[model samples]
Target: MFKFRKKKNKNKDSQALGGLDFLSIFMRTLKLLSDFIYVVIILVMMLGAGLGLGYLASQIDSVKVPSKETLVKQVSSVTLVSQMTYADGSLISDVDTDLLRTPVESSAISQNIKNAIISTEDENFESHDGVVPKAVFRALLTSVGGVGETSGGSTLTQQLLKQQILGDDPTFKRKAKEIIYALALERYMSKDEILTAYLNVSPFGRNNKGQNIAGVEEAAQGIFGVSAKDLTIPQAAFIAGLPQSPIVYSPYNSDGSLKDADDLSYGVSRQKDVLYNMYRSGYISKEEYENYKAYDITQDFLSSGVAETTSHDYLYYSVFDEAKDLMYDYLIKRDGVSDQDLKNDETKQAYQDLAEEALKTGGYTVKTTINSTVYNAMQTAAATYGSLLDDSTGEVQMGNVLMDNSTGAILGFVGGRDYNENQNNHAFNSYRSPGSSIKPILAYSVAIDQGLMGSASILSNYPTTFSSGEKIMHDTSEGTAMITLQEALNSSWNIPAYWTYQKLLSEGVDVESYMSKMGYLIDNYNIESLPLGGGIDVSVFQQTNAYQTLANGGVYNEGYMVDSIVDSDGTVIYQHEANPVRVYSAATASIMEELLRGVIKSGTTTSFKSVLTGLNSTLGNADWVGKTGTSNNYVDSWLVVSTPNVTLGSWAGHDDSSAMSTSSGTNNNKYIANLVNMIYQAAPEVIGTSDKFTLDSSVIKSDVLVSTGLKPATVSINGSNVSVSGTTTTSYWAKNGAGNTVYKFAIGGSDSDYQDAWQKILSGK
Candidate 1:
């Protein structure tokens, strides 16, 4: 309703004014036209290039494609076993020279896996005639944009043709030839035949130690330690996801352990993507997809046949398994032997066969971290102790791993009593419950690292209930009310450990993740098993490496057996190089070591002192530390011993988790002690039985009241103040113990009252 006079100006406002700027509009129009012309030019260029490539492909003489019968026949020929050697370049005798392939029928592979592949790689695999036009256009656009070759576009039939008849030349001519051959093959073969061949021939991945893993059968064995028919949804998803990029998604790295965190996360993400694709394609229900989506792929991972006790010497199995995987990866991935080349008539050898030929015929050398003298000692110890415990029942089996504390090098390994009697190598691949031995590494050390307590901090050692209303009590405490961290660990008391874990949990710490930081795989830290070291599984290798972390002042160095590998032509193919990762402070590690020494001095492991004395006088006086763990029903007994230079983790149990005879006069801990003593005696230079831990400067040694965990305090009693002082109670703390406390008490004036009061105060009654 309000009217205003318009002010006149030479400058125009595009929004305020009715008409737009003529020059600006003209420039924008020109820009849009130019952009259109630029796109047109790009299209013209791409079309010309594509037309030229097509013309040249038509002009080229047609190469002879293999017949269907010949293709199928070639798939099963001469899959060879890789060769293995000792560190000294000597060939391991009686090695299984036959090829390693346990082929599974095509129908046996899980439908989830098939659907996963179809969804991820080629969604139109069932309907397309070897290739999809839309996918081809997308790929062509991506390539023309200089984004490199995209993965999708080729149907399963086309992939089969590319793998079988047409080689991987990565040229325009090869691409054209593949298309032609794929079309022809599709006409010759049924859709089911193409899919089956593709599934069988696809390279899923290689395992750790360099073994060539091909086909669904080998892939299933390599990744899950199961046959193809037994593959679960998660396992199948992992395998089906690998053909896109074997090295990138493989659960095991080149060294035969789980991949690093980034790669592992990426691999898991890819698997989930495949699962989601299956879900979108209606191959799985929403509930099934959701359930499987929560599964962690690493939970079921086993590199090749590690879980299988193959018909080979168990002594060399650990390193041999790793070396084989490395050798195969090197031959194909590094040395440039394609799967097609492996299947070619000219090569006459699969990648594994080639690796074997290189070792056997080409004179390649395999090197490892095994210390020969220590290895022999461990072997002898196992045989002697095993025979003593055999009792003709053949139930007792022992596994041990001796590792260098400083270097993380595996010095010696024992799989079982005898390879001929039992094929399962409990040391390398098998997982067992660790029992109370895990206190220092899992619960107590983690608590120490988090600044919750020091060696002398007192924890209520009585039966206590957790937030979940679950109670934990120690068998060794016998109604004791309080104990220092050192005493609890030395005595293997469960209540103190569980209380410490609860403290950590209350502070929002994920104990399972904390244990993983020490290099063990765990899903969740259950309250019931955490303090007692039950409900968790670990291999001897993993357990020993964990103890090595304690001995190395909390620095975790991954344990590796192989040192270096040389090809037949004297080229260094692979090298073992590990950098120590510090997981806890030096003070924490030193405190843990000192506490473990208590186990040797007066706790569960004290019985081995005489055994140490009998082995060598130096060992008796050595500053050694150890812990003993006995599982439920005495099913598993463990003794992990460590000196400055060496650490040995030994497990004695029945293969089927049956009880060992406590009354049979065979003590597993004594046997382990004997083994440790022999290993030290055999390799005194490497082990140094008298070597002692060098405590960090931050690890301040202080005298404290054993019960109260404070600087030895004076108690007012019987009209006189008695000073409670002793050299026996020592504690290691970070810097000066500033925030620590000591319990104060008062007593009545009587001889009996004084005695009773002193007893209550001293004994934490």
Candidate 2:
């Protein structure tokens, strides 16, 4: 018993020692944790202190805010479209605000107008500071979620800051700047001063006279025919609702005419909302609101005069419209204004405001390739010629497109007559059938390029029906004979063209696919569509581009108008660079150019030379090439003219598609010829002096019998003259190494035999 008790005591003592050791380790670990916490606290304090010092340092060198007077002067400065000029430094036009702005003090504007704007734009204008925290939070939340529309609860002071101090950039950085600027503006200006500035700079859509109706004074004058102080409650409310969306609720059309009956009542709902807000805000009594709401103000609006400048000359307006579109595209493409981003109302409104400001306040210089001399001549010729086609029922319409063949720069454009009276821009919008003019690009040039046909390749002019059941009639009065491909295009013989198209199809050539590569906008594909410009509709811009490919030696150069865009600060923001894509061989282009020249010499456009000489005797021997086309029932007359330097396309027709009124033996082609003559007559001396066509050496010259479709003699040399006995013609062939240099294929013979011959020719066996 004594030994067992002694052992238990020793074990207990050992356990006690082990417990003490664990306690010591736990205490030490706790102390270490406490020290770590202290270190972390000290580090955090140092970081905070460093941030505070940096902020203080930044505050020490604060940017000086502009004084109220300086701010007002900066905002009120006029912005012109810096100046648009031609390549030759000739003035085209300058864009500026057509409205007359008369700045007024807050007291000068009617109290009703002030209350109406406050109710519509900023409900807490009188109560809130420059920045509304709740609205900013809401906007931030909406932007982050990418859902729901933000109710921008901006105060009037913030709006003023955005327009007068900050710019209309919808970036977050711009928003931050706006807040800072607004706070600074509030310190330097009173509430009345801010309101005055805001009221004087707001855009209220355009007046009936097509003039910008900016500022309260101009708005009152434009919408009510009254001064700002004399505006009625209803008129004030109506004008106040416009700043949110000027275009959607515009009282006038783009042409300065009253909105059509369907859209005349557009702003009624907004006007009612403004009135309700005004009454709720205690600016007007309920009885007054009811009376104003029920007021029939139609007569008041009717009494107002349209601003006198609402009208524009067609040529100037067309060019301006095109330039504006180009500017918008540039901003969208280069500036990253994605269409998805514009879905936000605020972003869209900011863009609209910026565009207006750029027009009225942002000084920018736009340079175009238009030549004033050529433009004037085209206009004059169109006016003189169009008068003859006009009947007592309606007027005739015309469109012209002039491009530099080598450069693809649009030198001149005419959309339509009387832009103010007719706002349709035919030059860009009209998509009429090119008629037979498409024969050169769609049929002849393509046929020649495939090595299936040369300029001297013969196509029977006998009457026939196509495989697609499209019937073609050959005019025997002009003499029924086999026509060369050059003659087929020059004279525009339908039967020969149809045969050429059939042969192309039999050879398994996708004619439409080939033409598309050549930059022809073909909308439909059919066998019959190959001969004439049928089953497709194309614009003058596109037609000129296709022909320019031929002029540019088969390299397609995209047609462009704006050469460069310079901001008011003299920075070049946009410049055009040529991107030429080879669509056809140089040899093929050379041969086609020769054939087109034959057109001017003795084909459908032969009368052009006579017209040119008649217009200007100095141009008597002027070397030019072109083609003429007349649509079914003479609905459209087209002419395309090309010199080595310039290519011009003109069209005359009625917009309604009614048959042209013939002056009892009037040749419709003469209109095209006359217009082209006028354009060439006005060409600069340098153009005539520099214009020269160089033939490609790759084109082999051979004398071939048209009837047999074979070289009569093997020429020992490439350029040596070869003799042909009968029915022989000199042909310039694009050296494509198409074997079996003869096609015994004959039209009006057995179809199986011709097909067999074509199959052999295609295989090059």
Candidate 3:
């Protein structure tokens, strides 16, 4: 009984210890649960606090501190580089303006501001506190439907905030930022200051420079060419509406009257809204608003700046092309932009955003070399001839190029009939047949280089034949003729040119090598038959440089259109210096110049005769050394002239390569010559007389004579027998049938009239 009791007590103690162990386990489990709950609560509080801190940090970061230095740099008055003007201060085709922001303070500008605010955004802006509650409510309701409209319901201050702080993209984050900025702006600035800032930042239109129109004043001056103070109510409204979409609403962008119903309706509607708002806000008297509301919308709102010049001449198109090309290149490199980026919409938008950022960051200014007045004159000349020169006719497309010989500055150029109709630059880009223009260089330079002929060398114009086994050259000019090298060049005689080519070939001057030296890649060479004076290919820019070499006394100065480029800070980024290199001897170029002058005075280029008579006579009788080239079948016509001060080359041809009417008279039928002369007449006086040089009389001697492969005997009318004359005047004597001594008589009178008579004489008229 004692043993059983002890065992039972041990068992009871063991059971009690087990119960205690179970309690300890339960207590440990409860403690773990409590610790886990505390951890969960701490984690939740920490996450919440972290999120709240991040949100607050973002809000603080969004509040930008306005930098006065940045603002000064970004918003200083931009002085447009004033274009070099004529003596009379008439703008050359070039324009210059200050780049910094200019304020609009004119009464007309106030009126436009009042009108635009009322018309586009709020009819109750005067009573709003930085926000239009109704419009905001409407926008919120619209957002709920998921079809957000493009039209903004933001007040002017909000709009300014969006533009300045939030950027152009309409996004929720941007809107929030704009609201914050608007509230901040309202606290720091007056309504007028906000409005002025808005006006200064708003884009009213685009100038050729790719800059947006800033203020009402700038918009008025840029779009209408008038000051803001002179703007009419209708004009103001029209300009105000442009900020909505400048390219789309531009009067110049479309083919319609400024008073087109759509345009007037839009302008009038906007203007009325503006007036109604102004009247309600007491900014304008009820009478003033009513009177403006009654103003006729049909009347044309003419602005007063530079009157648009009309250009019908081909030369204008050529120059415009050069300018456009330069402009395109400038834009491309100005900011390291690419063509593909311009083509892609998203990329383009990105570029615009970058540009806006750059505008804020600042660094770009473009300076052109064109003279505005000269450009205008060129445009007018082009416009005058637009109807007569149908671009479709390969015979009469016009090309004009004007450059300052001394500086290599291209003053004005026109490549085609119109830039709107055709964008290809005929002046600098199009390669046209240069015709007889290539003859002077060939006759003077190539012949001398080959040791075949000298400037004063003489050759018989008598007909002869050439054969490279299969090809033959036949002289088509009537009668056997003889002419000096200079005379041959001035008259553009095919026989002399052929003979010269033959002589060069005999002297081992390969046709390709010779042409290559003169800037041509001659792929085909028919020793027996080549288009001697028939055709040659070259670009206006190349041709201009060639003539420029002659003008600069045989120095080749590369042609350039941009004078200088500067950063927004007025630091020079690019500076073009004069680089002159000798391409030919002074003697060779002088001889060529005299010969070319003979062209204007007496050669086939007699079209310039009337225009250059006075100048030619007074300036040592120095005339343009010019050449008139008409393509075979009259497909293209070219007139290239080089003066001491400038080199002007013009071409008229159809883009399609169709034939032109040769019936207009040999030299008179060509339109390019007439166009060139018009440009010369209208040229600014800054391009003074061409450099003067004395011709080396020793280099002017007439020596050797050989028949061109086309004519047989040298023909001369000595009292009518048409006797053959020797190459040199000293080698042969002349006499009439009476056996009396006869003298060589000039076939035609002054150099101006000689060319026509020579042609008639050559044709046996």
Candidate 4:
């Protein structure tokens, strides 16, 4: 019994010791954990601090910080209003409203506006050194946790930085950059200066009038019909709240109409929030806050009917596009921007964005080649006569482009039947087959320029088939006989054009080289119908520019709308430089010009000749040259007319490529002719330079057999040589005796069949 009791007692003692040891170990572990918690907190703080410092130091040297002087200058200056005007200084439009958004000074703004904006946008604007670190920490936690967006903790200064410099990307990296820039900005600008710049640069969305209103001053004026200086407390609260969600709180729709009463709840709700913030900031008392919050802010909004749609919508696009092109050229030529970047679409887009931004905001003064007088007259004439053919089932549309041949500048254009009905710039924006009009340029010019044929060379007008079994048809049934080149062109016959093109192909002529120099790109090569406009196409502007080269004495200049652009600093950034390319010899152009004269004189454009007969009394019978084109099945109609000084190209068709009736095409032609008649009536000086065709001394203008393209061959009628005169015609020939070697091919004769043709010329057959 004693042994058992002693053992039990020892066991109890051992158990008690073990329990004490367990408690001691637990106590040590508890104390160590307590100490490690502090260490962990310290390590986290050190890591965050190290990362923040490293990021700040990394961007510090690279980030450009504005000096106080530069900040003040930026705050004081306003963007210049962009203007586009006629060469005569006639106003086209106040292109933009940079002048209307006049910046209000600190003294000019109301205290209530400052208070409302400060309380709502940044509660501690007056106290912080551009950042609120605690809010930033909360934002970082929220962002890292992915629990919310990254906009939770930006100070007013940081918001300004985001608006002006750092973009508002919802990322921790952007936030860090924003914090850095915000801190730097505070050092270079005062509190009021920062606020002023913010107010001036911030977008305030559209007003009740539905015009894009920006800046605090414009917001106040546009939303409440009150200036920023005169804004009441309610108006101030409303305007101050707009920067948070401008479009959502806007009182108007895109069409300048007032929003629905229910739809306006957002702006009203936002205004109440602004008033509450003001009350919390002690800027307004409870009584004042309630009074202004209950005051109907919508009652102050401007109320009017929807704004009327404006005209000349296409002109703006034309001017802006041409101006951007000129700017791109200037950037490449003057600023030495790398042209290799323009080859890549993405990098080229970057360069384009840069140039476009400058044009939109750089306060550029753009001068255009659009002659207001001539443009207005053409517009009026087109509208009047074009309506004669406009019908319900098929709405006829017309596009006319007039170019100054001397300068290669577009003088005027008739864009469409009505801009509201159709905004497509048919003259410049769309391309269509020019039909037989392609003959004179692609076929005849190649033949003449290559010394293949004279203007009066006889060609077989019989029908031919392509190798692909496509039949070439003629507009009239009289095309089965042999005819001179001038007759074939004037008659708008396709068989003759095909024969000529075949001859050109057989002779190894580089027709595309000639076409390219005239800016006519051959999209379809080796097509037999190319000479008849079956394979190639062009816009009225392009066709006119190409033909203008012929009128410009073989010199080609790319047509441009922008004349001279003066930057806001009064520096001429662009001056229209004539980069003339010689596409053909002056003698060749002269011969082609004379050959084309028959088109208007006695061919398809005979109606235009009647109009010219009237205008000739003023310019001492000014001669006009022109050509007409009709796409297959009358899908498109074209008429191009020119004097030595200017060329006007016209096209008429449906946007959907639907064919019109023959009468409709004729009426379109008549409308185009009338447009030219009115232009000549309005601006006769467009052709005041020269009406007579020119031929260089290197070319001989002589009489030749229309059948043989050679001066009547001498015959042995007597001892003296007698000239055979079966059928004689006048044409320009190379003085070096380079006659058309392909004349035999035109008459369905190859180079081996030359003896039969010479025998006929010798016998006067």
Candidate 5:
């Protein structure tokens, strides 16, 4: 053991030399590996630089970058407020924006606001040329990164381009174009120009009154009652944070009501985020950040104390909504978008957003069909009378729409008594049950047009129900057993309409077609009581237009609010062109007109007939025709009426579908009457047409027996068969002069005995 140990010790120098040799080889291999890694890193950097440059260069050709002059002009151009004019070219209001927008120069804006926005929205605004390459790459991978998770890859230049020019399409092509445009724009405009333009165009959100504010100037003025130049750090911090999520972080709700102190946490929290960014970016020190972080942004949000909409200003929103739809269709066609592409919801929403953006920024002159004189007069009248319909809760409201019978252009309306009190455009928004008012358009006109029934064709008006034992109701407690169609209509008897609907169904006549042509869609056509105004809802606009067809010589012209739209340069972009439909034949219209004329004179709407007579007293002998409706349980009251020149539809109901306090037949008739008088007083030209209704040549009036509603057979002693004067009543017919036998149709608890009962009536045994 001693000898072996000594031998091992003797080889110690050789062991140390061997270890040194191995260490030198290992060091040499490590150096070689380090050099290779260095070369690889350099190559990778070169490759990245080449790819980035090539990517940017490839976009240059695809993107038609505007010239430097155009770019400068676009960024510096003013955003003009669009105008909405009445038919006579007088200003009704300024559209596009609801509140006043104060155009500000860059010098007037507070430096604090600029710094706050810069720190939060785009930290690289000053340092970057156009974009951050690394940020762009990440956005391409995950999302169209905005101001990138913390520092969104999108610079101020890119954001401005995205909002003002390149829309939010969420497409690779759109992102590529956005990058290309941003780079081009940076070369053309100065940093100050880009920042100022961004500040001016950016939407800071709704103010304390819920009015949408676009520029910093309006934001400051409407929110804090201070000028943009006077915004403090806290106010600027709050405003700077709003562009990311305007409505969500706004202090006011959509109804122009201020949010509760507790509900305003989002705005407070977002402001803190802005302050933290400001602190991190060196715009604010740690002490300032901590102080502003504790600042209550909601406390400084002074109430704007301004009305969101004036008495008649609410009409603009409806008009704008309609215009958006029109622009959507127009843009889709102009861009040659295929129908298949529209099935994609994203693509459709992008177009919708584009249309909305154009309306807000296009500086359009929207010519509307409103008659200011009539509108003012009607509004004045409605103020006095509409209060009569308000319930104790002030929840019951009224709506009315007056339309030109010739063109279906909306002439005037009563959306609500006060726009500030309620922003819902009742005339366009509310869809209440139409009740018996639908009888004229749906049941009788279809029956008349189908040649199954005549204006005076007899209907058995006894108590009856459906073949399936469905309950039938009449305006009165009971129905007359044997009544002419004219008398049934005069009384709004539901039994006759029910029988007519059944007959139409048996004969395969489509009542929905006529209703659709008159601008009322029937989603509940299968409802048994649909003929009596059940299972369907209609707005004043729809009811008025439906009646307009009857007065417009059977021509159904779709109702229009906007007559035309002209761009800022006075170039006509859209002109109202009507596509008139022949909803009813001339004979059908004339016969139905004659039938409904008695409705105003002596039937359900007779109470308001005096107003029509008084207003038309000096104009001419033009007749008035109308239909009255009351939904089940008196939840809604409706009057759709027409004169020679115009049609008016009015409704009274609760927003929550609560029953009206008025009884079934007496519903708000006085209000309707007063509105008519006020309309005439405001503008007599509204009902100026003196032309008498002309009946069709095919129609003939004949006297029928009082007992059976049949033409008396060569009576021995009788006066002319002009009307049911004494022993006979007047009747209308196109074939054989209304000599058909009495059908006397009725239904029991079951439909088993209907045919037999009719057969027995025919037999007279």
Candidate 6:
């Protein structure tokens, strides 16, 4: 009975403990659920805060950097040399530059502005927000739909965005970048800013620097030399229409009238449409628009300023090369650009492609140092002379030059007869045997400098042979008499020249150094006959410049035609400074002047007597110096003439050194002399009268006697009535019909009264 009671109590206790355990389990489950709900609420709030911070960060980053279009709008500004003027101060020409003008605010508006902005472009620009969704959709649909042609969905804004924010290179990545930048720009900036950036960055044309120019204002001023404010509605429209493809619509793209005319017609039509659009948009009154549309736009637009039409004037071209190389160096050094950046295969390819595109591009204004008037005259003169040549005989080629004696400024030049036929400029490119023209510089000038021979010093005009087997002979008229050094120069006696060379060699002067000083050398010559003026080659350019040094009073100033180079922005990039060095004594130059004067008066160039006589009378008895030369077998002919103000040179020859049929004449009747005569006829006014030297009366008579170019004592002639006193004798009397002495002139004697004698001989007084 006791055991049964104990078991019942134990069961009751177990049931109570079980009930407490169930309650504890239920409470724990409820607590866990409450904790989970709290966690969920905290996570929701945290996510909301993180998303807000991320949005703010994106907006902040967007505001920090400019859009790609804005960045592209800022191009490298080009520098150039401003033009120098003549003594009269007329502008030689405008300078070359990339920037057209200073940027202006966008609020200002003109009919030209309206026309340039809205005509054939997005006509609905006022209604769109940096994009035209409809156009984009249409383009995408056509392209994706595999239509026959791919359409451009870019609106005017998008195009501007591409040009101003992105670069000229077209790529998918860049396009995407442009879109992003354009969208961001639209969000943060006003419409006016976007338009301004677009106008400033869009390429209207190229400048003389070969850099792309952007903006109508800059293009108008740069290409037309007129300000945007001064441009008419049609002009504005013309600028506006160019950006579609500037080179393709350029007026100066070709020489053919038909092609140029076609381009002009297309440009004009597009310009008219721009005007009409401006009128319809109320940007301009209908009457104003109509007046502009009727205006003549084909008025030789390039003539608005200086234009570089062709590649002639090799000196100018050389300066251009130097300037370009300098600029290239400046760019590399200043910009810290590596060689790879400049000459990399990819970069070269890019430049090549750009060059191809540039061929069609126009509206570039290049201002060079070349004087257009002088250059034109020189070209015309060369052409006239070339036309006179019988190409069948192959004596047609020619070279010409005009330079400022004081400054060594090359005013005019012609490298060849015609640049079209022979692109090589013989004046600078072809080196030929200079013949006796080099005698004056290398021999006479050196002699004067060494004090071994003065202008009045006497030298024997007799036959002599060097130890090296080089024979020198004088002309027969002079005989073996004595003549002044000045007389020998005038007559170009081979013996006198040889003696002078020997004297120079005997002195401490090294032949190589002396030749280099005078800027002449024999590339290969008969060393034994070095004094004979053989085997030396010189370009017409070098000869002209060397002569110019004489004209400039022995100061060796490099002859250059370019005055300055200017950028489109009117900034000076290069202004040539005189680089002068004394090459010879002033006395030597004066002596050379005196001798050259004798040449024109009475020397080997007697054929030019009529022209020289006329020229002298016109210049108030002013004296000029000149020289004539003919190569062996008449392969080359050269003539150089100089006054105080100008020096001119001419060369005539076949490019391949082949002898022309007309060149076979025995008398050395050089074609160069004929070409020079032609030039004088065309521009007689260019010969100035201020040269101070007077012709030496004694030298003139002495040269006349030296026609056979020997000393007077060594010549022989016959006459019964005339008395001969020297080692040789010549007849002095010309008898009349009755055998009376009508004219009596001494042949084998020096004349102290040369002036009176020449007057009697020339005037028959």
TM-scores for all candidates: the values are: 0.58, 0.69, 0.47, 0.73, 0.72, 0.49
lDDT by residue for model 2 (567-653), tens: 776778778889888776788887888888888878453476666667666554655667777677667777777777777777777
Q: Least lDDT summed over 10 consecutive residues: which range in candidate 4?
A: 1-10
Worst 10 residues of 2 by lDDT: 1-10
Model 5 local distance difference test score: 0.72
Task: Estimate the lDDT of model 2.
Answer: 0.66
Query: Regarding lDDT, does 1 or 6 come out ahead?
Result: 1
Q: Write the per-residue lDDT of candidate 5 for residues 1-765, one digit (tens) a residue.
A: 000011122112111112224445445334433633332222234334445423322322234556667666666555677778888999977765554456688999999999999999888888775767666555443442243354355788888887776666554445656665665676666788789888887887777667777888988987788999999999999999989998888888865678877768888889999999899999999998888888777778786465645444567787788888887887677544567767778878988997876776668888899998988888898788776666554556789999999999999998986887787777999887899898888888877777666666767676676658765766445554656777878888888888778778878887778877776777767788888887888888988888899888778999999999888878788999989999887778888889888887784555667654554565324577888888887788888778878999999887788776654245466678778878877787787546567788877676765555665443311233222122566766544465633333222112333344333433553
**Candidate 4 structure quality by residue, lDDT tens digits, 642-679:** 78889989888889998878765567656766676678
lDDT of 6 at 51: 51
TM-score of 3: 0.47
Error of 2 at 502 (Å): 4.1
Error of model 1, residue 188, in angstroms? 32
Decoy 1 TM-score against native: 0.58
Clashing pairs in 5: 147-152, 148-151, 148-152, 148-153, 724-728, 724-729, 724-730
Instruction: Tell me the lDDT of model 3 at 504.
Output: 62
List the global CA lDDT of all models: 0.66, 0.66, 0.52, 0.70, 0.72, 0.54
lDDT tens digits, residues 1-765, model 3? 000011212112111112234445445334433633332222223234445433432332333434334432333233333222232434333332223245665344555555555555555555555555446655654655557674656787776654443444433334444543444445455556556666666666443233445676776666556776677766665666666666555543222224356754664566566567556766668888788788874354442222233333333333333334444454346534456546756545644553434333333343556676676667776777545555333335566778777677887777666677776777877886766666556544655543444444455455444443332232244424556665666666666666666666666665564445436655556533354543357777777777877777667777776665455566765556777766666656665676677667774544555544533433324345667666666666677777688887777767777776653224332344445445546653544555455564434343222222112244444335544333333211111101111222221122333334344444655
Poorly placed runs, candidate 5 (over 4 Å): 1-74, 96-134, 144-151, 171-177, 183-192, 204-317, 324-362, 386-396, 419-424, 468-471, 603-605, 611-616, 654-667, 697-765
Index of the highest-lDDT prediction: 5
- lDDT by residue for model 6 over 347-455, one digit each (tens)? 4344344332221221222344455556666666566545554445544566677777888777667887656666778877788877668777777776666655445
Among the numbered candidates, top TM-score falls to 4
